[model samples]
Target: MTLLRHTSKEIKDRSALTINPAKTCQPVGAMYAALGIHGCLPHSHGSQGCCAYHRTMLTRHYKEPVYAGTSSFTEGASVFGGQANLLQAFQNIFEIYDPEVVAVHSTCLSETIGDDMPQIADKAVKEGKVPEGKVVVTASTPSYVGSHVTGFANMVQGMVKGLATKKDKKNGKINVIPGFVEPSDMGEIKRLCKLMDVPIILFPDTDGVLNGPLTGKHKMFPDGGVTVEELRDTANSMGTLALGEWGSSLAAKYLDSTHKVPCQILGLPLGLTATDSFIDALRKMAGKSVPAEISFERGQLVDVMKDYHQYLYRRKVALAGDPDQLIALTEFLVSLDMIPAHIVTGTPGKKFEERIREITKDVPYKVNVKVEGDMFMLHQWIKNDPVDLLIGNTYMKYIARDEDIPLVRHGLPILDRVGHQYFPTVGYKGGLRLLEKILDAILTRKDRDDPETSFELAL
Candidate 1:
């Protein structure tokens, strides 16, 4: 029997349960965000198992070694609170790892016990667990609450609150929070900004940290990531451009409110429209015209879209991923005249559904959209009304195989494939890569299904 053979074609209303959830726990996202900081150690205030699982998830996804500390909560610590364990963790992390910053995030156990992260972190400092010039930041990321996307946002907000401070004068630079994208995407964003000659401070930038070269020597803290100085100087930047609403907005809003740094919250630059908005925002903020190089890249992407219209037009696609990425992707699909038949995200937000509906309102067919939904529901939808292409993480492959649909892995936890950490899916060039992938999937399917006599060697 197939993996999804039990999936019913009749979609039933489900609440209070999520099978094969589209999102992971919060600690994973927190750990990923913390790794974007230079010389930083992510500490989990919960069971050792939780920390290990979080590390393993990231390590598998990025195909790199991931290091994190845990409170090692036993039965006793779980009831009496893990405060002692956390303080000792701080002492050991500072003494052993010697990281510049210790980013502490809470798990389900710690959050359920109502442990106060701020108080414990302060206690660690008072007890000299944190050495002089070293910093400690804390974020509450309970698994029972929102998904990993929420945890990412919370940790970013923690970074801003703990480090950012206003200076005497503006630095005439921009602060960019790249959201929960791959290191390649972050690098692409930097490249676009550099092309426009705009100075930007991108925090939690994991470009070099996660996607380091295969040198003979191994360094615990790779020489990538945003330095402590840059994070502190974010307040002095002239403005801020937050990339994703869920992952980057909290930190930007905090900076705007606390330090008077003006911010513009935009979607992740995944496809053409989103990239255009990002470039335009950069152009306006920097008071510079759109450079010819960027214009040329945009033209290339447009040319390809026009050239391949026949292959992509009116092909139905089903998507499951984070809200920000899905929004931009949905818009991109619509621009290609492809129908987003069904879309689901585990993150809870009515606005996501509303925005998706608005984007696909003019499509020929009615779209099925859901927030706080699971993959099981998506499979059910696909069973009832099938799609030609499926886009999401590696987990979606099961549904793709069982339903005989082509899959394009695009989001987090893509363990079965590589190159996402090296090749971007954002910006104009990134859009070209994405278009190529979509075309490849569609054409490959056609080659597999079409008769030999009808198969064209030129297409």
Candidate 2:
């Protein structure tokens, strides 16, 4: 008997319900973004349970201890509004934790009750709850509104609105918003910039904060993240590069409108063409030529792809993740002559579906794509039309097991796996890693299913 035996191949309409959602709540993304700020403690302006769920999700995903303060709203606060709870939380967080910044985000409970976060934050500042030089930034992240990707965008924009200020003198630096990626990916983006000899200030940089090395002594705040000064100096930079439209464009647009910073929005650099675009953008913006080292890495990625073309060509793949990731991954799969048979993202955006279809338009087979869809739908598609490989988070494992397909975990809430927090999947180097994973999954399956007599000693 199969686990998903009850699932029907016939696709049905589902508007009011979502089964096994691919995305988490807003507060989780907000807390993750807040942690990217140096010495910043995220505060959830809602019930303690909400904060706990958010923290637990992030902790499991990153395999790190995530700290966050909660308003701890009781029945009384729920009816009367959570302003008092938020104010008290601010006072306690400052006095006890003593962080340099308190990043606050609203939840469904607080938002539904009509609590004004900015007003309460201002009151906290007026009452001296926040000490001198310490900042209190707030983002309206109602869990009912959007997915975690939206929450990340809101919090990043809030950070810019609250801290970034234009100075008379330019810093000759560029601002790079790396989007909602892993800490290792952020580190890779920074390394690429350094190789290009371009000065960049990457905000919400979790490279050192989330992926820190363990030591004998434990510290509440790690030696990573973009500093408060760096956030402020974003306004003085030459230009801004927003890596992903969903996770980073909001903050970049804010800076452009308020501080006259030029902004360019691009997709996440998941493969060859996208990486080239990123490097080209950096080269043009910083007035520098592409470094020989960077060119060599690109050549190596191309060479490897050519060498392994037989393994990846025309392979059918199913993908589910955030919109930004799906867009880039779909294009990459098409480039490798792989059919992206089924694609789904829980985030609601028509542009996501449109972009996916556009990428797969020239493919030989019809593609199944959905925006704001659930894992159940993806499983149904797989049951009706099976793919050779599955690329998604841990949730896809059940489908993989039932369908007998190879799995390549690549998105958020990757609870069962590690190394994504340490290794990148974004740059040219990351592209190589992704290619290696894909080939390994495909070839390993081939080895398993093929007869022993027909097996070759070497490729």
Candidate 3:
């Protein structure tokens, strides 16, 4: 409660100030996106600290080895230019690391100085620093302009632009942009695609790369990741499914415009309705039926909802996370007849604000929504209008404790939890798990607050 001493319950306009940001910087997202590409080395084209911080954060979140290269900018590079540093990095990376692709992303320093990565890359290739047949892609990811999600989208678009090729023949394969979701969520999506019998090409797949096994040796480029071949064939796919407009739509839109591959933007498959939409989209795109197995999974989730609706009905809640996650999570909470009294995201966009407003319009209680916002504002809202449950990343735990509210961890950087790393939260099974966690939090609170005389074992 006292973590932010300067914060107050009174909501005021502070045009330039942002505290406890819900989203991280851009280069981190770029690094994560690069991990999804097979034999692709993520190179940070800025100060070494930026790369170090990104690698640390990603490593902590996934509890796995995150391998990335850096331009290792110095004072001279910062004052003059980083082109020489990057060119040298390219030579060293190609010669030593020997990755098939180098996914380069810019930082605040490079972008501020207007470093032309493309030109530098071209020079490197011409100077014979870049090996033939190897690839070098770049994304303009200034930390000042957009959040990590935007960086992820930009890097993915860069990957497509650099690697995807239009062939004469069209393949039945469907391209899936999984967005900035967990490795587990990516794996779950692949599972759902397989069950639907859809020949899908999921880009930036960090399945085994980010969530790899405890092998004796560490692989710089993990076994998991969309291969170069897969990326090349993406342009020849029948269509593309981009989940989460904020984190994925840009790349999908780019692919559509450039390659004539039609694109459909869908929310992350979280709740029953969202999952249904995803399944329906798959069915239509694949020209096939939803397999009975998938239906059974849906049925199981519905069964859980039916059994637990009483526990969750009309429960007031507060939520904070990325835009795509907030949208899907809000929808899921609303489906349970839960009041998402407060919602916030640090990622700035009119679209995010509009979507949130549109979602909460029908709610009985007033919903406090903010974009380009901070956690301090969310905490102030919670202080003013206390909620029964707080749902967000582990950062919300501080507020939950001070307010004595139950909390369900449901977003990125879940530093303290284990399941968010390995368990699925994107499909029917994911819905079931979400329902279970919410119920567990609510009921545990109920049990803790109930009078001793009125406490019933069954209830």
Candidate 4:
């Protein structure tokens, strides 16, 4: 079969550059995720605008304060260095926020100006600007190298490298590295672990911190996360499980190097195949059988799969989102017998491409995959070949509306909807959520086309 390609006019270089960019500026989302950890203060080492934009976006999506620090770079600071700005900010945050940990990430401007954040942060640490037992971790996530996904990965690496302690052995413990997933998903993962009777350490947890309920007053740091203790304990884990490709590298590498703990990289637990891999990994590492409760949940997911087979079979979908988001969604789509007619991600990586190819190999039709491609290209191909639904961030909202297709918001930002990060979309519970969204989109589109008077209630 021949694959249809978009013309330059259909996807022009400039106009097609990005009708709506699917991803956000790097450091913000990374900061948002980090803040979910209990007592973490995410510091943006750049201009105030970057920090403001990032905080505003998170607040809009999550309805939280989304606290963070800005270097407040001015003309003098930009050229000379942001050392002073960061030093002041560091002192201010520790004094004010008084969190146990501060996570520092670079913005585009700081990266362009060549600010030495590690040296600056180190100065703060050495001079006692940072308090006792309080830690500061730095990540060089220049936005130009990639998208928010890259920054998230870099920040994860930074956490493991900076905070994890050396020389220890901890039994009945496993390390879980969940990628850029929703806070609700993180909560469900923890819940499942508890039901399985497995002891584990989860990093960068945001379940309550990111999706906290309002009690009238704004908080600088929400009280939920992996804790500084968990970050330090990663090296001592019996084994490490990397959730997705992006956020798993650093911890896995560190554990291997320092603690000699084995690391297993698995896909986001979105579908049956990936979720099974996650549970099985845990069971083996713990030397325990699959708990009855988890087994029943799996059986229920299979029951729904049987029920939704006809509704999902042979459907075509357009997917555009973060790499981990797109990959997990694609895997889930295929499991339901949906064809991802087009897959697009802003972040460019070989593993992203290879994973897509591997997941779709068993499908009957050839699947189209594109990484590092913009939404303009995605829109062009969607026009070239019709699809049943679109799954991704709000950037695809306009395109889906124009084409009269249904769209489901999943992944970072989810600007068009509230509580996406708060809602669960992983494991068996998350699988059911995926099933509901897919069915809703498909049914909604069908209802629109069916004659108003002639449409039947029963399929």
Best by lDDT: 1
Q: Over the full model, what C-alpha lDDT does candidate 3 score relative to the true structure?
A: 0.90
Of the two candidates 1 and 4, the one with more favorable TM-score, higher being better, is: 1
- Candidate 2, clashing residue pairs? none
Off by over 4 Å in 4: 1-19, 452-454
What is the per-residue lDDT of model 2 for residues 1-459, given as tens digits with 9 covering 90 to 100? Answer: 777777788989988988878787888888999999999999999989988898888899888888999999999999999888888888899999999999999999999999999999999999998899999999999998779999999999999999998899989999999999999999999999999999999988999888877887777988889999999999999999999899999999999999999999999988998999999999999999998999999999999999999989989999999999999899889988899999989988788988888889999998999888889999999988889999999888989888899899999989999989999999989999999999999999988888989886776
Model 1 over residues 1-459: C-alpha lDDT tens digits? Answer: 798777888877877778888898888999999999999999999999999999989999999988899999999999999999999999999999899999999999999998999999999999999899999999999998888999999999999898998889999899999998999998999999999999999987889888988879999999988988999999999889999898999999999999999999999988899999999998998898988999999999999999999999999999999999999899999999999999999988789999999999899999999899889999999988999999999999999999999999999889999989999999999999999999999999999999988997978
Worst window of 10 by summed lDDT in candidate 2: 1-10
- How displaced is residue 3 in candidate 2, in Å? 3.1
TM-score of 4: 0.94
Candidate 2's TM-score: 0.99
Clash counts for the predictions, in order: 0, 0, 0, 0
Q: Write the per-residue lDDT of candidate 3 for residues 1-459, one digit (tens) a residue.
A: 365566678988888878888888889988999999999999999999999999988887888888899999899999999999999999999999999999999999999989999899999999999999998999999999879988999999989988889999999999999988998999999999999899999998999888888759878778889998999999999999999998899889988999999999999888888889988998998799988999999999889888888888889998899999999999888888889998999887889888877887888989999888888899999989988898888888888777788889887778777887788889999988888898889888888889999896985
Candidate 3: clashing pairs of residues: none
Each candidate's lDDT (Cα)?
Answer: 0.93, 0.92, 0.90, 0.80
Candidate 1, which ten residues in sequence have the lowest lDDT sum? 11-20
Our tally of clashes for model 2 stands at 0
Candidate 2 off by > 4 Å: none
TM-score for all predictions? 0.99, 0.99, 0.98, 0.94
- Model 4 is weakest, by summed lDDT over 10 consecutive residues, at 1-10
Question: Clashes in candidate 4: how many?
Answer: 0
